[model samples]
Target: MEVIAAVAAGAIASACQNAVLSSWLVSICPQRDYAKELGERLSRNAHIYTPGSDNFAAATTRWSAAHAPEAKLVVIPSIENDVAETVKYANELGMPYLAVNGGHGAIKTVGKMKNGIQIWMHQLNGVELSEDETQAKIGGGAKTKAVTDALWAAGKQTVTGLCECTSILGPGLGGGHGVLQGRYGLVSDQFVSMNIVLADGSLRTIDESSDLWWAMKGAGHNFGIVTSVTSKIYDIIHRDWAYESFIFTGDKVEALYENINSHLPNGGSLPVDIMHYSFFFNNPEVDPNNPLIMFFIIQEGNMIVDPTYTKPFHDLNPIAVDGEGGVFTDLATWMGNANTSPPCKKAGLVNYRFPIDVESYNIPAQRQVYDLFASATKETPALNGSFFLFEGYSTQGVKAIPSESTAYPFRGDNLLISPVINYAAGADAEIDAKAVELGENLRRILHEGSGREEMHTYVNYAYGEETKQNMYGYEQWRQDKLLELKNKYDPERKFSFYAPIV
Candidate 1:
């Protein structure tokens, strides 16, 4: 290693809020003519940014401040080849590097990457429709809002994450869940081809023909950096959308969950046109002693949710009922995941999510978790902002794909549950440890209730404590395939910052 120059320190002084600049990790990397040296290898349009320098904030800003990486440099790739050049430059100097798109990944493993260079991909953003209109070529850095707006303008749509601020490939590569998944399958299922920069710094366009394509769909973070992707697109069939929300107090937990089970007996029987999202959040004003349960039943192609779904919940006598109707674009706003929504805000909050994929909600487990959550939040007022999420999306499209076809192994699971513990950043070590413990305990109740020996979790929302079998599948073949691919593609594990297979 070499000594860092005063110029880097000067930049850090200018941007005190940038985590990469504020951390002691800056001492680990040697200073060099990073801008001039790397710039020469990249295209003329490519630009390099250091802390407090030219759009550095845009490249460095993150949704959650928890377990974030410390970058010594931020390189913006104007084109696909620029990514390869940057990767090579980082490799030659023996520096760690990470790809930043939406900047929303907050897993604890990412914090392991120190004195690294962030290959900021925002400059590679755009979308182009093929002549046949059957597919769309999306830039790897493009956000969900961009793709949704672009496709909706062309009277088309595709499977994407629920949040507008998230990058298409950021979550897609993880087999991300979306409301339209019931119709088109998971985000990865829509992939046709992709331009990825492998660990060896080689850029190649791969598709179903490539042996690595199977791993790229799910667990892609471990293999390489995707620069661009061609994905299957669908015509906009239902322009209009409607949703009905039911809010209840703690007393109705059993009744509400039991009702849901009666409808989705096996967790995989949800209708393709419907999606349900529910959560428990603290609202002392509404229920001082407990969190309020908010349930959303969204329906496609209609201005009002059908009574078939809403009627049953209405019969339960929810404390409050609200409904909204609008076009497909309005769905995110209604669901509080729009670009401007609070959850989408880049607040300096430390968020830890303990996620699990279960066959169905256990009524007893739900009650226990709720009580535990209420008590924990009450004990620590700072954590009162936490929310327990239960995502119920139609599984027809997910299950329609062969279980062994892709790296995503939880297709059979019907529900996505997680306890998102949010608290102020810069908390003491004891506070952080307490948050982790509470999150784990909350998830444990549900896992025990499911009665599955192997806990299943969504890799995208992993808490970093889960085992390989928990995030991936438990089967020997799934583990063997992922391990084999990891060995072949990333021998040195350069891409191991986020949920490494090893």
Candidate 2:
């Protein structure tokens, strides 16, 4: 309430770009009232939407304390012209804005605004499936579940994020990774074309024909607001089944990772119908001494029996087994709480990433990470979080395209290794400090063994205060090009928010 004066005047300034058309939503409404308004809007449209303050607050809170709250005005622009009007107003007022789809961005703070516009992109949620069911035009706001359900109903398939709540375009823009990643390629690779509203408030279509499309691949959000995205869809070769394998504690973590790295590199044509993830949890109901660690594989339809897909891991003798027929979405739900993040009880987050190599097979390094996490679990008993490690599936499909095609720079790297430590929201400062300490310890152990340091960080998984350059890791030429694009297109820095380059 105290900040309403500035926010209101600012909103007025922005809406005036097309005074005849633009609608002005309040910049700062009471949190409770904001939720009611958002729910009402959703009730009416059921399709087009701008998220409420609760949604933004929940997302902001999920971020580390260093970047808790941003984006004052939530704008729902129905058409491309409306987006142009919104952008033009922000440009004239020199106010920053952030785009939101499913609000599933991993770089939670990146698109935040101090007190500017939050252009909620969910308003554009239409999907047009092709007659052959091999492709679709998905509005930028469509979530994975929306696309999956839509495509499934049409008896087609497209590689999508395994987590149902993740937005299709949001993740695809940054090189989407999912269960199908090992087969078809990262989601960005599936991009056929897209309609984008540029910083100048004009519309442009991007695809292989335009250099801008290449730039949009990995560097998308930096240029403009995306209205819709087109991607390849495949025939439904299989349905109503997802193969699952749960590798437990005695499976030998080191060997399991090694096997994964070896198997995921083959292109999809080689039988990569399986999606994989590993989990480490301490269940009071199970074991108090050693946390229960499990690995999961979800094979779509008949792909469950594909030897290359399940054989490598099945040989490991997983302790528990559930091989059944179910909807992929149902399988995701059965997995339980696929979307619960670490309660944001802290001020900072400490994360370290290194490239995965044969050294990851070392038992000492594996135990080192596990021991460090175990101690933290005991020390901060109130902190609720777990450490995770995953490798990038092969770039066969992603790399088949020229490197110059997109802003994603990690195509050259075979795998990505990440370790995380999350804690209660209010406990961020201490939690961050401890996580950093442990991260450094793990870094030293791994790097000393592997001889690599501070190399690259995954954009989707990066956290607070680490610079943007570190996450992108482009070559000198590409970095220069990005900076040039930032200056040329967004010269006023209206898009700069959390973890920004400008």
Candidate 3:
């Protein structure tokens, strides 16, 4: 047992907080000496940032201010070895540490890492393609735009999220959904291998051959800090895409879902090349009482209008239509820009995965959810800009993969519904509480409508309130297997900050 100094006694309120007492464990512990040693062990390209420093502020800036966790120090490693050495040093000092890649995570657990060290991966952003062009090695800190730009330049592409600022690996570790997921699969499905620095400061490569690879596929954040990821890539089959956007009033919610159900019966029959998504929100400019629905349809080919797939949407008589056909890269750029814009910034986002069976579209329940969203926005003006996003990505390719092959459980046909609650900074506590309640209520409604007792949630979009069964799986055997792996790989629970299973 180690004695904590009087100055650090006040910080120890929980087990995690106690982990940070490493700085005060020994009377002779030299803080500057430890930082110096870590610096010497890292490569010349590595950099360190302290609190109040310009680089530190930049490194800690997150998509949502609510998820920014304070750190005693921040280190950006240039290579995998530097990460391993930093982990080893932290372990030696008994200092708690958190690994941050894209800094877009919104779970409350992120804000709980008080007085801990932050292992920033920004300096490790690198992307390289193999000579055969079948695979690309992406650094852990590489964002969606960087990966897409690199692959686009090489006439190749991979599965990545819509937000370009989000890390390629951060979402991939849980389950990456993107425009191309309908044709290919989630980003994790395309993973070939990863270079990870384990909790014990060991550098190891996790591939399909490794027993731990299965766990790394879905619940990877709990295992280790990945330094790089190698995933399968394909040449761009069609550079241009037929993109269409439609806006509808709240009265058309039922018709909108009916059309959506008609297009995606059993959630599996949709054309793999087509991706459909809808956004429901209250825009005062559109209507004060009713929420507006913005539906987007994207097809891989360059047809000005995909007659077979997109004509039905045209029949709905959308309020507005834009962009008959455009380059796929242009579409990606547009999405990235929209997500980072001021209206979308500093928002609290949560997601729920609802499995839609054949002809199981519950219009009543969905309408209620939409109504709840409208009421919430109306009652709280601060949340008027918030919206609910329904991502109906084609899951034929996802279902093609076996459940046992990887740890991703939600591989079947499903609709990922996310409630993005936006509030002004320093908003009243009542507004924040209402936003959380609205998001959870919407999730519950969708879960019950899906006819499943246990709700399934995407790990990346979870708000840290979901049970282990919801995030991992409801089956006992699956839970046992995941727990077994958890014990084997991270018994000490070092990486237990984000959606931890232990």
In model 2, where is the ten-residue run with the lowest total lDDT?
350-359
User: After superposing candidate 1, which stretches have Cα over 4 Å from the reference?
Assistant: 1-31, 264-266
- Please tell me which predicted candidate would have the highest TM-score against the true structure: 1
Global fold similarity of model 2 (TM-score): 0.77
State the lDDT at 331 in candidate 1: 88
Candidate 2 lDDT tens digits, 244-333: 656466336766666765764433332454555565666656566555666655666653445666677777776666555576556556
**Best by the lDDT measure:** 1
Q: Tens digit of lDDT per residue, candidate 1, span 196-298?
A: 9999899999999999999998899999999999999999998999999999989999999998888645356788989888999998887888899999999
**lDDT of model 2 at position 228:** 88
Q: Write the per-residue lDDT of candidate 3 for residues 1-502, one digit (tens) a residue.
A: 2456643544433322233344445443323455576798889989888888898888877766665678878999998899998998888767778999877787767777777789999778899999899999999999887888899999999888877677888998887878788778889999999999998999998899998899888888989999999999998988877777788888888888988887655367777778777888777876868789988877777656466766777787878777567776676544434445653353443322222222245788889889998888898787787778787777877888888787777787467777877676676677778877878888778777877666778888778778888788777877888899888888898888888887
Which pairs of residues have clashing backbones in candidate 3? none
* Cα RMSD of predicted structure 3: 4.6
Worst window of 10 by summed lDDT in candidate 3: 350-359
| Candidate 2: stretches off by over 4 Å | 1-66, 106-112, 131-133, 258-270, 301-319, 334-363, 389-395, 414-416, 439-450, 467-469
What TM-score does each of the candidates earn?
0.93, 0.77, 0.90
